[model samples]
Target: MTKETIQKTNPDKIDSILSDYILHDKLHQAVMISAPWGTGKTWYIQKKFIPSFESQHKKTWGVIYVSLFGITNFKELDDIIYHQFLDFYLSKSIHKKIPSKAIRFGETALSIVFANKLGLSSEDEMNKALKLIPQPDHIVYILDDIERSGLNLGELFGYVNNLCEHENSRVILVANESQILGRFNDTHKDKDKNNSVNTENIVTDEEKRIEAYYSAKEKTVGLTIKFQAAPDEVFEQVLNKVVDKREVQNLIRQEKNFILDLFTCSSNNDTETILNLRVLAFIDVTIADLYDSVKQYLDVFGKDNSFNDCLPSMINTAKNKIILDMVRYTALECFKFKMGKNLDGQSFSYLGSSNHYIYFLHIFPFVQRYIKQRIMNQDAVANYLKIVLKEEMVNQRLTKSVFPILNEWWLMNDLKVEKAIEQLEREEIPEGVGPEYIRGMMITLITLRERGFSIPIQHFTDKIIKYLNSMDKISFNNSAFSIVSIFANKDFIDLYNRTMKPVYDYVSQRLLDASLVEYRFLIDLQWDEEFPIKCRNHIASFSSDRRFLSIVSAEKISDKLKNANPGEIWYFCKGIREVYNISNVSDFYRADYETVDLVCKVIRDLIQQYEKHSLNKVKTSNLKMLLNLLDQTREKME
Candidate 1:
């Protein structure tokens, strides 16, 4: 019936039904398309159904659409419909002679002339004006957001009845009927308490209103079509609009069903299916952005040789796994976050059990940051990916060669143990090996030596220390240095006590000293007009160690606060709050609470200095708030 055919597989046959209704020469009543909100009813009517209808019957009928979302009275509705018809008439009568560029001006001039000439100030006058159309019967009027309209239902439906019966116009209404009924029911509840003279047998005012509503609907509406869209189909349509990358598109295509499953089930209820296309588009776009970042990260780290080395034939499989894991994570997290749920910790728990490269790629700290902030820190993502890739590769090498035999040493004979020890010795520890891996190796070797394997544990320890010394300063500072206490060996415990403990302590103090210097510079930069986010993140980079604290002296801070402008003072206070806010939760920042308290006292004196002057109100207020925050931090820490 229409140019764009609905698939025969679609059992609803809604397109055919609507086509028949629209093609009828005379419409006795308006057709209402009803669905729940966010079910893509509006999108279907305007984008798919209308385009097909128009394409099939061009010039035979004119289409006019109006949204009754916020219309509260008759005149607002009249004005919108009047303008649609005016534009239609202008296009047919006057636009033929006017150049395309001047048509806008011509329409504006004609609108003013017609409104004044017709004196169209009321609905009756507007309807009179609308009759000026060459063939009013040829126009098909589509009104959307009917449930959101503030107009009384009877009055609104009466107007529609006039158009259908008298003006001989076809009308289609798109609405969420549930919302309309729910609103009316809520109104009834509110009024039930106000009515004092309700007799038990009498039909009440609420019932009368509802009856009138249905009566008007019965008079005006010929057919009501319940609208339901397939979630998968709608998601496909939305994804096609938002995603252009072929790889991303393919990944989504492959996992479309599974992704939808994760999303529909993310509410933790198996039976609930949340099909919101607006949310779907947003999630697809987020997935594409995250996938692009992953691509760039992988590009920087070169290709994954893990698959090439271990399963040479499954290279494509490995690549797809990486992309798919990212897609799954992005989809689930976007759904959860946008739905106001906490991050799904279960999705990330695999990181603890598996050292798979795929698991490494699915680490979601960067993802959580991106989702919450709406800013992709590509450099940070790439750097973290680089670190994960290195660790995964090293872990793979160790797991394949040495770790298995060492971990299950009882199954290995004397020759196998000797070979494992030799492999451990020959394994030239990489420069940036994570401390966890290093400690694991040290424990295994020391245990083997204690078990009489002649493992040369001290030589291995020295080599590990040498590599730790050679690691880049930033990487070394960021290392987590995981500690395992399960081992009861005197030698391994003694090694940690004698060597590893002091090394980590020295490294921690060195990092703290360096961070204090950087913190001072960041404090000064905070007063500058442009405090870059890169700078802020660099300051927050030390947050995990809990050693991050401002070391600026109270005298210098007082001098800076006195000279700083309002915006500078605002940013400076923000930085101080952000830095000290962490001190509330961290025991490490407790040592610096005295310094913060002194700064608060300095700001108190500054506020007093500016309190008597009207010119320093902004700076004084900022200092006052900063002092309050510092005071709260001190109390919390105490």
Candidate 2:
């Protein structure tokens, strides 16, 4: 088998068993290969079984493969088998030397003549005409997706029995036997309740269907083999097939083991193994897309080597974190896409809990958007990652130029200390700089003063407070104190609480209250088409205060909802649901509960008002749904 081909389970054993059955010319029964869904059974059979058979018994067997998926009737099954048989026989015929174009032209001409004179335009008529062609001998038939067929199991197995016993054709059946049995039990639970084979027979209809199925299998299916495949081998084959960019491919290849383990191993001792190849394909694509975004982030901000120089070990840890988080996120998305549900607690142990904001990847809004919508928004991702890296540097007490000096302050000479003090004095805090930079400067000055360096620590604190008080607007809020506590050491925390906390809180609160223009713009967008995007951006913004609901105007929102069109109202309510859902986990949105009750009341009133107007039924129904959603959100909050 090629490296790019998915590896079959116990290939040599299967090959030997199948070879024995095929080489025995007088076929009496069909062989069944059984496995769970998405285990690469179909791939292995096509890529492995067919080639081995053709190589070893080319003249002794004629193989015809047919998928029984969605085959509702015997006629449909017959048509498919007939077509496959025609292709297999023609490929081995003397007419194979004839160009396919001439063969197709002759067939089309024959079809036209039959349609006009012989009335063979209908499918049954066409089938009757085609059956006149000579049949090929020594046929080996592969019937796949047997469980997926719409035909009844008893009738389907009977057909296969006839093909094996009467026609003397070798047959291979591929299916998930458990699924077949499960489907039988489910559909036949009450079938023919009054009918009984005998008076002593108290069997349910489900038991009857199962008995009939097994009886047919006993006559037709000679042997059954369980299929299995190594997930790593299958994943590698899929990686080689789907991923195009070599660098991205190599990046994913590094995490092949962890990714496979996530699917195959259950943390809660659950016996079921997913080992889904389709989910693996999605994961490979997700990781490749996210890896590109990570590359772009590095390209944008990697040139500033000072942070790297100061903390190489931390930098390496963070880099490794980026790759692992990418895989974790991809695994989660793939599971949800393929399984149609979120991960359970058992999976959370491996994939990382979304409630934990300590991991930057789990909460990054743009990355979440990319995973769900498949729209990268590269600029947003790059910008978000840049802030995340900066936060990492700040939390580790290493900024661009300031932290290096203070980190090694004791080893530095007097001139260096003076230069560092001068840099802090003259440096203008940028418009969007985090509190960590300000906190870092304060911590450095406090350290200098404690060391008897004659540093004016109080002077710098006064200067910063005055500067912050004089600003026309400030985006930082009281919640920023949480960030301060995160990055602060014992001494800085003491000094900040004792001296700076009250004054900083008053000034920051004033600035936060003053910075209402952005919030107003966002609230006004409830009538615009861009409400959803703007609302998400508002929540995800680093500088903007997310505690808008604590201060938001319910009357204003209700008034706008009254005037907006259906699409705008949908977007508005969608944005509201997003905020309420996010509020369930985000501390930043905890204060939102103070006003959400009022918003819920407004939604209920709107629902009732829209109910009166027959023209606004869509709006009324949507409002009712939104009210129910709000009720659920409130329950979660309680």
Candidate 3:
């Protein structure tokens, strides 16, 4: 880059000096630019300096940029240089004269194309130029990744020197000096040829070895510029159009202490990588959502929105959750890109789009423990971080809050909506507000709204029953009912027809199961309008339970479920449906455990043969149902 332009870009102290040296017409020796990775050295030289140097310099006609990153030999290097020149000419639409000996290889399409660029308008001119090919002295060569090439360093240096000294072409070498030359060995201590060698001889030998190591570099390299790009300048250049700068800057200021501590006393290379990525975090929240700025809101905390507008979101793209999954995926990918392994030592790969769900929820808690929890309590998070990062289960339970549930789309399929509802029920409810029934009522209202039907609150259930009865393919069968079930409890009637009689029979049996005596009494008091007060008293008195449930003076069934766990409430809601053997488990007081097992096993076998749903599906659902039934015994819930 020109001195003025580069200075304006970064104001680095070295810009002017380097720009002046590059712009100078003197061509006594080659020049070298040395810098570590991510310093924008290559970018600045290629994008700015070369164009400026060629434009501003008097002697230079064209600049040739060649990266010897993986080139192994002189032949490979020659091919790259030639192709890059042709590309450069193709880009510029310019042609230069070439000597005859170079075109003597003959008249192939390749020769013609290259010969035409060499200013030979006809095949005769190309043949005439073929007998005496001369080096292009007007071209300046920029050889990058000098240390990465597999060619011998001393040999390569000598070649570069020959191009400058004999071919009269200007050369620039780009590399990291420290990376190319590691710490000097104690070769000074080793005697050369004999023990008679003195200290002065040893010193001279060491200097010669260091100089001769580069072979021609001592004489060929006239100027060596260390590329120390300014930090703020680099960030501004890289992130100017990528993100919302003002807002990210504020967030960064808030997190300045943490970021500073993280990279304090770190090596320059390590620090440089982190600085670039910290800039990335604000613009795009990485997998951990550590520095995510996008805010999220849920209909939680007994807010007005909870009842006024309740919609069961099956899939959530809530910004923070997306950031969490995104950052997690990115972190692992970064590791894999660098180290060839994920944090868990499994070599991960993306298969189309399955990666979106892979390890996301499983590792979210760990990410939270490390990146988030520490902000609240260092000690708590410290302990939590240890377990989670080690591939162990998290100490904290996976939160089942409404916000979290919204993002768990994998658990909300038509086959798994019941699990979603159950999980939602597991959240810590706000006091005195029964949101589930409100949710239920909202659901009913929304359905009615969609169907262009309306009913009073008291008449809603009756209307739903009437509507379902009006529809075909449903009825109440005999004592021995066909086993039927729906995936969601709320889908009880609206979702299925064949389940009516089987569900009713199961509910009646479970009510009389004797284990849930108080539960049965409460339901009778709540659901049956004509339920005799005398019968309710008899039922309540039938058990010496601590809580006496009544008919007219009955508490809402929801009140009893207020403190119930998700599993328990799930059981209370769908506890009877399990009798269909689709989601059955041996939690209730049944005839026998063996019989229940045998029944489930038979149903499972039938499912496997015909696989109506799936045996595995039944097993998974049954396990959930069993857990729900078990939790139902723990406490009353709403």
Q: Give a tens-digit lDDT track for model 3, residues 1-638.
A: 21112112232444566555544636647777776655577877776766666667534366778888888788888766766655444333334433323432112343766565666687777555543322356557889987777765656777887877777667778887665553122222234467443565432454665654444456677767766555545445544444455654444444333332222213234333233333333323332234332222221211323233322331122322433443444444432333223233122212111111122322333343333223434344344333322221121123334524433444455434445444443443322222122233324333333334332433433433343334343222221121111111233334322324334444344434443543454454332333344334443232222122221121344343333444443443343332222222222222233333333343334335534555344444544454343344222211
Pairs clashing within candidate 2:
none
Total backbone clashes of model 2?
0
| Total backbone collisions for each predicted model | 0, 0, 22
Each prediction's TM-score versus the true structure = 0.50, 0.54, 0.38
Give candidate 3's TM-score. Answer: 0.38
- Specify the poorest-scoring 10-residue window by lDDT in model 1: 349-358
Q: Return the top candidate by TM-score.
A: 2
Could you tell me which 10 consecutive residues in candidate 3 have the lowest summed lDDT?
Answer: 479-488
Model 2 stretches astray by more than 4 angstroms: 1-12, 24-27, 96-137, 185-209, 266-274, 304-317, 343-363, 394-638
Lowest-sum lDDT 10-residue window in model 2? 351-360
Ranked candidates, highest lDDT first:
1, 2, 3
Question: Of the pair 1 and 2, which is ahead by TM-score?
Answer: 2
Q: In candidate 2, residue 435 scores what lDDT?
A: 53
The 0-to-1 C-alpha lDDT of every candidate, in the order given, reads 0.62, 0.62, 0.43
